[model samples]
Target: MSDNSGFFERVYEVCRKIPEGKVTSYGAIAKYLGAARSARMVGWAMNSSHNLEDVPAHRVVNRNGVLTGKHHFGGTNAMQQLLEEEGVQVKKLQILDFEKHFWDPMKELPQEI
Candidate 1:
């Protein structure tokens, strides 16, 4: 496996912790994993996670809560569709009431980062 594969698994682990109806950002996950500058790595992880069954990759968005990764989900709106199914509203590819639905792993997870 490539070095990225390990980090990708770590990203997926953090993703699995995101609750239903809640959303987090690539930056948030990276920061939580103690790699604050690795937000793009988290995005890469999400892009490669489509085939996984329980990662809930839809729950992740850009820091501003935009569905920037929507294109990776097979359909133009599949990411938004999944979020909507989880009770999150999206508008113009951005999540509505973003802060209200935001899930910060740094805050939600029990361990210190």
Candidate 2:
């Protein structure tokens, strides 16, 4: 499972654009990258993104609006706390207002160069 540099960069770029209190899914990013089944690859890139200062990885969740990255967070319940601080409500690993907070780059983003 070699992590290519460009692929990771693409993941970070997309992940960085997710607004605070809003969320996106790995499958969406993979599709945006033109690899529809590469959602796991997107997750791999995110797991390796330890040095990104501005990329709020916590803002991303599973397709079902579940906070699936809780184990990866440092402090106990940190991912939920971060999301809540950004005005996203979470209840037992699920986002409260999912429809309003979900962000789909394919719809909201400008065309790529």
Candidate 3:
């Protein structure tokens, strides 16, 4: 009912579509949701998504491919560990070959119905 909850659902919907071994930026998700300036809100949604196993919160990183949300995943390296498990390279808290791994929701998803 609340606007944030609705937005969080939208965020999760996009997250579910993020394929393994790939990642997206918070800003990208916000842009795809028609809220270009709501990247921080997208980060908030990722932080709140731990309980939802299907959300793939680890696949959402900052624009520069930094693991900015790592702290929220319990361990300091939890986020990095998860991404690494999926074969995404993380070094010094940043994703290597970032662009190669980046998934743009606006491009990956079909036109909105």
Best by lDDT: 3
lDDT of 1 by residue, 1-113 (tens): 58899889989988998999999999999998889999999999999998999899999999999998998988678889889999999999999999899999988997632
Report the C-alpha lDDT of model 3 over 1-113, residue by residue, as the tens digit. 49999999999999999999999999999999999999999999999999998899999999999999998988778889889999999999999999999999889898541
| Alpha carbon lDDT of each predicted model | 0.91, 0.84, 0.93
TM-scores for every predicted model = 0.94, 0.91, 0.95
lDDT string for model 2 (1-113, tens) is 34567887888898999988799988888888887898888887877776777888888788999988777787489899999999999999999989899999899787531
The lowest-lDDT stretch of 10 consecutive residues in candidate 3 is 104-113
Measured with C-alpha atoms, the lDDT of residue 113 in candidate 2 is 11
Q: Put the candidates in TM-score order, highest first.
A: 3, 1, 2
Where does candidate 2 clash, by residue pair?
A: none
Judging by lDDT, tell me the better candidate of 1 and 2. Answer: 1
Q: What is the alpha-carbon RMSD of candidate 2 to the true structure?
A: 1.7
Q: Which structure is stronger by TM-score: 2 or 3? A: 3
Q: Which candidate should be chosen as best, given TM-score against the real structure?
A: 3
TM-score of 3: 0.95
